[model samples]
Target: MASPQIIADTEYLPTLLKLLDRAEKTIDIMEYSFAIGSATGRLNRNSAPFEIADKLIEIKESLGKKIRIRLYIEGYRETASRNMVTAEYLKEHGIEVVYGATHAKGFCIDNKFLLFGSTNLTQQSILKNHETNLLLNDKKAIAGFNKYFEFHWKGGGHGGVILPPPMIADGVFKDVLVDMIDRAEKSLNFSIYFFHISEIEKAFIRAHKRKVKITGLIHHHDAFALSYVRRTRGTAERMNDAGIKDLHYGPGTLFTHSKFLVMDNKEVMLGTGNWLHEDVEVHPQLYIHLKDPTLATNLTKHLQKTLRTVKRHRKEYTDSISI
Candidate 1:
């Protein structure tokens, strides 16, 4: 396997399962909307989480106390209920699971492989949603991620904060993202969901006005999600009016859920959480910065693929969710 590989779109679940099957000693996972087989109580044998649970069990037969899987959902309503049931099922299988506002998403397997990104552990995130995740097996990346996973795992009930190790414990993910955006030297290619965070938007505008080539996709403004139009509409108008015309939104509602920024096609910052101000203050978000050109290039390709499905204006974005 390559040291750094970009796993995007529908490639996430299969890659995850392959890693689980190959686990030699340890497997640690932290997901926001968790689900697994024998937990849905609907005999969901075909769900992505089902296959994930099945694979974990297959490995657990050999490495009992060594494999650790932790999933804490930050979702609401049905998602919360689903996470509880899944957590119980995993516990019965000797895997530790809990619930909280743990919005981080990643997988660290056997100290060699680490996958972190904007996708959750639910069926929709794995099998359907257009997500961005990076897989790293390089020594430094793997070591850092191992520290990152242990940092969260040790947090126990609260699912830890998203700062990762060696970073200041009091730091927040929004600052990290804003700082990265503020320092943009050349360009940014992004595919993000929920654009309600004004500070990040302001930093983005600053970069754009400085002649940074900013382009990316957003979830269509007309989705059925709560206040969906309001969130995306303001963002779209602000960017468009600022002369950032390379923006596109749509490919339906679900496909644009990627939250990632590739800086100059050299570094990638990706993981869970929307850019909503209220959520940023309360939720445990994960945003990692890696200076890997190969990963950034792959993420850019992922963002550009949807340009064919998105429209530039508000009146044309086809809503995937019916009102």
Candidate 2:
């Protein structure tokens, strides 16, 4: 089996664009958030997110019916306007665009390459944020991702009804995560964007009580400026107080937008949703659990390396807390 390659930072966007440029047969995309233009506060002028959308449009226009392009996006009405406009534009140009509560960030190119991870197809994710993705040239891995996409493409519904599989479905995923954490024998490593679920927090506390080495890396910025930061900080502090000593916050320069967990260097879980209750209950998300030791070890090492770059928060909570 060909091993999957981990791509991070600036390499992700260019690599995705190159794959899209080279695709000949089909392009399947699943994203939680996708925008056409540059994101606000973007430093670079040459935006890769817009370039990717433009590339897909160009492919559809140039190939006409020769190429097949399908995009499955999250269609919650609150954020529906932008995605709907993009969907309409793509549909008008002959691309198949389906909107649902999709939170899976991935792409399958001509059945030859599969890329999936924490990176959303947005300007912020591609150019400005810190993200991690796995690119697989292995046929077996590609087949698995293809199966997942096909299952959702046919059975998925708008809102929160799109069920990919029983193991990773809504409510089930939360149980699976808690079970995974509870069953950890040696270590638990996690890199998450947002986390507010109490069950998950209690599971980690339990693991720590069992003498399991628990470590985590979370984003410093609260997605929204209002209560999001407060909630995130509260969760982090609570976890720290509960005995998960190694939890560290990522720097504000690049958002740590990865959602993954490694248990005992033997199993790994990667997915789209934050560890929040609403994400699992109301949003369409994908969670892939694997027992590959190689992948798990690599992800664990990556997490440790990323943690080294950021400052560790003091083990003290202040009354005047601000994220």
Candidate 3:
């Protein structure tokens, strides 16, 4: 089995670009959103989004018909024009571009390597947001994702809907998560953004009652706070009240946009989707559950280190919960 490595924050863009530059035979990209502009924010250093796009274009132009490049993008109604423009730009540059309703983000290079996670190919996602991605060199894992890519490439469902197989389908996400939490023997750690699902909160409460150590890092920026203050704050208060006292708000520098769970350092669930009830019901998300001890240990250490840097909200339970 090839060892998995976790790539987080702004590192994903540059690493992905390097892979794109080195791709020998084929490059398959699946992203939920795409924009043509520069990446901005603290970590990105004003990097241009076209830096990656242009590199792919350059490879296609230089390699001529020897290389195969296909980009599958989400066809969101609100951003149809932008997707169309980006698709046209790539199509003009010898790359095949297709639009579909997908919330999956991943890249497959030469059918030997794969990178997939919650990060989208946009300015905010690449440069500004706190994203989590896993790079795998394992042939089996690569082949599995390649199969998924091929399924979507051939247009599996109506209106270009790409569905994961039954084992890891969307319908099982909540059930799998709750089961993982329920089966935790030692610890449950999660770092997430926009976590408003009540079932997950109840799971945490139940785990706390089971004497399992639970820790969470939730997003607390103005962008999320403005729209989801009640949900975010209320969840934190409820968790704290339930005795999971290690809950902390995200650091100011990064957006804490990762959605992952580490159960007892034995299994890791990494993927897209904000753990929102509506997202589970409607959005097309993808996640992989791995039983690699090395990855679980590394991710656990990383989450603990990140938790140390975050600010914990001191709660004073009065007549009502604070938002």
Every candidate's lDDT: 0.68, 0.75, 0.74
lDDT of 3 by residue, 1-323 (tens): 65588988788887888888788899998777766732221233244456677888999989988999999887765555556666777898999988776677888899877898878777777887777899988676666666666666677532233333321434357777888999998999888887888888899999999999987778766543465646777888888887889777775446778889999998988887778875677766677778877898898888876665442322321112122
Prediction 2 TM-score vs. true: 0.84
- Identify the runs in model 3 with alpha carbons over 4 angstroms from their true place: 38-46, 77-80, 157-167, 224-229, 311-323
TM-score to true structure, per model: 0.83, 0.84, 0.86
Query: Across residues 131-222, which tens digit of lDDT does each residue of candidate 1 receive?
Result: 77877775665565555555555554232434433222212657777887888889888877777878888888999988999986777644
Residue ranges of candidate 2 with Cα displaced over 4 Å: 38-45, 137-144, 151-155, 158-167, 222-225, 312-323
Estimate, for each residue in 28-123, the C-alpha lDDT of model 2 and write its tens digit.
Answer: 998777766323322332556667777899988888888999998777745566666566667877889877767778889999887888887667
Order by TM-score, highest first: 3, 2, 1
Q: Which of the two candidates, 1 or 2, achieves a greater lDDT against the reference?
A: 2
